[model samples]
Target: MGGSTSASPCSSYQPSPSTVPFQRPPSRFKDINKNHVRLDLNSMVSTLVSDLGSVDINLKKQRSGLLKKHRDSQYRLVELQLVVRFPCFTMTGTPPSLFTMPPRRRANSVRCGKATQVSGETHRVTEKNGNDSLDICRVLNGMWQTSGGWDRIDRDDAVEAMLRYADAGLSTFDMADHYGPAEDLYGIFINRVRQERPPEYLEKVRGLTKWVPPPVKMTSSFVRDSVNVSRKRMDVASLDMLQFHWWDYANTGYLDALKHLTDLKEGKIKTVALTNFDTERLQIILENEIPVVSNQVQHSIVDMRSQQKMAELCQLTGVKLITYGTVMGGLLSEKFLDTNLNIPFAGPPLNTPSLQKYKRMVDAWGGWSLFQALLQTLKGIATKHGVSIATRCR
Candidate 1:
């Protein structure tokens, strides 16, 4: 997905981690006369594991039903590889610490350890025409990793990771025009799927690509040409979703651009959407009768500016939200918890574009100290619920 940060007034302090011990209260202090409740951590963990297993089974059943329906309708067969992987576990349902240490690479594999076994659910969004819809994974595999500063991503490894995610049911991917080689990488991965997997599984994969164009005259040919380029790069005859982004709303040309994109829906595009548009411009687009299914925006626990107005307007207009920065470029995880956000780095600096972008958001949200407190509270909740801090943040 594309990257952007929100600046809004927010709290500067958050509750610290619940340090109150998990032990039962003393008999003298207990309210025996009234009803009492107690929680057992072990039992909660067991239930969580059971629920996850049930969800996995249900997802498989759903996939099977969908595939059958597609075949009955004579739609193109898109086969999905069903692979099972084991989940990581710890005795206490939490990691050893809240600090992310530097990664230690293995000689044979780019990934440090076994892949985690979590799958995203799928949802279908109907287009404005209501004649067709797109099924997308709730958790989109973002391709911003290809952007500079994270690390040198080997092309082969990146394609392998895409396959791994697809096998795990994360079939929807989000990429953009500016993200380096992201579209080309998707083309390679899809070609691999076509060559190796069953034809039925091909329809399960969806790529939601973006068009971040410079503010200029948005002629019919210009819009068609840009979208055709993305389609060629991704090796798709028709794009699943084409999200248009404009840097400066002052130009007043975005309307013409979106109109032209909407005109192309008859051919190369399936659904047209928006990215990083505020409520005001979104209103303008809607008033112009543009058929937008969703708006990609920066939304997380810390930054809630969207909820204040954008969400309400979307509710009224029936426009859904595709959120990014939910984990703040991994800063919301335990790795950054309790760290000195102000001091210079003892090791390598925060080099990735995502880290640099979200660090500024952390500072604007209330600096490092407040964020640490939030992380601590999140850790406590995650432990009680038998999930990782990263999962809780998401």
Candidate 2:
């Protein structure tokens, strides 16, 4: 909503897609521990190469094609044979820029040895053979605020804010076509990365955007045109990741759309994932032989639905779960701890879209009283750890 898309802001160039090699983890791992994720380069090479043939044929081909493009590069085969793993969080050949940030200025942020830092926090980054292969920070910057209702967003200011986040090692960004000016801002930001930052910085910044289309006949041309528009707006030869959202399941056109999206993985998109899809629909997609790498869903402490059915399916099928709303749109913070909003004008108003949306969720999850108790408990834990509730959320 803050930039122009009359023309591409920057020229598109092909960046070699990188993959991480991973084996399936035990199903008992309910949560990902960022500090413990490490890759065993030696073990990963042979196992990943051997496991390639037995996995999803389409994904194998995709990884094979990406690998061929980087055959000549000095990319090492990294083994993500960690104890706690997510199906979607694995990697193969390491990108040169991903782990090579300078130590002096970035010593606190980029720990190339154990884990990659993300905004002073660490997240587990892994990949599965059947899932998406691209690398990203576990904590993503959701750009829904760009759609509207926040404030008048200055284009230069928005781009500068993005640069600050990337520079802080919080490089993975999540946006959508409907999020006005988000793709445009990303286009300008990425061009700046290409021209100003080092190649490593460019590799670290991932723009994972979503495509939410109406329930129309999902012809190849229709899907291609839609995807091309995002590519043009983002000014990227290939999208880092495309997360698709469909409104209606009765139309059944989502399968066709996903098929076409799967075909476009040749060079147009690095990874294809889903957004707001439930366990049943996800199973249907997987049953139809679609190569969906991850399913982006609303997952937070207050809303644990994804952990119930979706987590089981994902764990069984190796599909990664990309979660959002983990902070309950900031309602989980200390700001809401000792306040009561129901008493006339007594507390901070749930004015923002996110705040209002999650306020209802807080209500349904046993109302403000229970939520306050939960927040108080969390605040106590944060105090014990010498971290704020927001920091604990990160």
List model 1 lDDT by residue over 1-394, tens digit each. Answer: 0112222322111111112222222212112122111111110000111111111112233233322222234322232111121121101111111111112321111111123433423122233323435666546778766644455667889899999878866677898776667788899999999999998678789898878777688899988988888888889999999988775667999999999998988979999988778788888999998888877766555554555466657656667667676676778777877778567784235666667666776665445665665666666656766665666321
Every candidate's CA RMSD:
21.1, 19.3
Q: In model 1, which range of ten residues has the least summed lDDT?
A: 39-48
TM-score of 2: 0.70
Question: How would you encode candidate 2's per-residue C-alpha lDDT over 33-108 as one tens digit per residue?
Answer: 1111111111011111111111211223213322222234543222211111122222211110111112123122
Query: What is the TM-score of each predicted model, taking all chains together?
Result: 0.69, 0.70
Q: Which ten residues in a row have the lowest lDDT in candidate 2?
A: 42-51
Measured by lDDT, the strongest candidate is 2
- Backbone atom clashes (below 3 Å) for every candidate: 10, 14
114 Cα displacement, candidate 1 (Å): 11
